[model samples]
Target: MAHTAEIQCPRSISEEDRARAQFYQLLGTLLSAPPSSELLRGLASLQGDETLLGVASRNLAALAERTNPQDAEREYNTLFIGVSRGELLPYASYYLTGFLNEKPLAELRTDLMARGIKPRSNVHEPEDHLSTLCEIMAGIITGEFPCDRNLISQKAFFDAHLAKWAALFFTDLEKAQSAVFYTPVGSLGRVFMAIETDAFAIQ
Candidate 1:
């Protein structure tokens, strides 16, 4: 839910992987912004011949149009700005070290800097923000970054950040009291994250 990056895909990817990467990128883009009429149009035009993503996109577009503003506002508050804090803490340091703003964030920033990746100027979250992490993952898998994200680096980074908490985050999103339109999104993320984890492990 913290997604805010604009990761571009490399043109050199195979067709299948490129489409897969596009789905993640679209996911990131949708999460980064509140739904707008333009985004609704984009979602409406999604090719839905055979992809769950396409179907989901179609539903998301319809839901976005029919979403009551009050309901969406409340859902946003409950998910991101609870009276105290949300049930899921989507931060890297929190997941890895069981603390916030710890060494894990520091280490991630170090790596990000080395890779010429910087958090967007408008983003107020820490460098290892969950959205940024997802963008990084998609970027890595798509070779959007300068270096190839070999299995070793992917495993190391994911284990260090997402592997520890993404499933829990998705589960919390799935069960969030305010979720309506977002519950299916949460389910999709949970299932896909698990699948990605296993795929990487076996590779």
Candidate 2:
């Protein structure tokens, strides 16, 4: 779950597509594990404009500036890795089916196989993990997969795996009592998911 390989795009990617991919990558990285000191510093340097997502980004950057790695780790563990289970389960299967490793995970694995996308051998979690799905979306946008790289393909994947429940998960994250550094993360995700849904609707 911690390993992600660099993918060289086979074709030219537009700046907008690149930005979208980067956003997905950022979300995936933040959710996959606790932020390292370096990551926290980098996030602190981020700047945003007047857009809704930009506001959320700016808020996150502000929080990142005040957050130390140790506090961030503790917050992450509380939200995702408590004694029995975390405060929130960041998995699509659980969100959609009230359980983990159910039909949604099976469907995702089948789709991933069809797209020639596979999880790293070291990852023990199911493919339905929100972080994993976000990473896969980033890969698709950046032409990392063998399939066609277009809005149509992206929409298909989004509708199948994420459109159903990502916003709800983000909302829960935003409201979780253990959240501090992750509050803006949830806000950003919620806003982004709405934007994506609207964009995909028009396509």
Query: Best candidate per TM-score, number?
Result: 2
Candidate achieving the largest lDDT: 2
**C-alpha displacement of 89 in model 2, angstroms?**
0.3
lDDT of 1 at 89: 66
Q: Candidate 1 on 64-107: residue-level lDDT in tens? A: 66665566656666676678985556677887678889998888
Cα deviation of 13 in candidate 1 (Å)?
0.4
**lDDT of each model, Cα atoms only?**
0.66, 0.90
lDDT for residue 9 in candidate 1, whole number 0-100: 57
TM-score of 2: 0.95
What TM-score, computed on C-alpha atoms, does each candidate reach? 0.75, 0.95
- The residue-by-residue lDDT of candidate 2 on 165-194, one tens digit each, is 999999999999999999999999999999
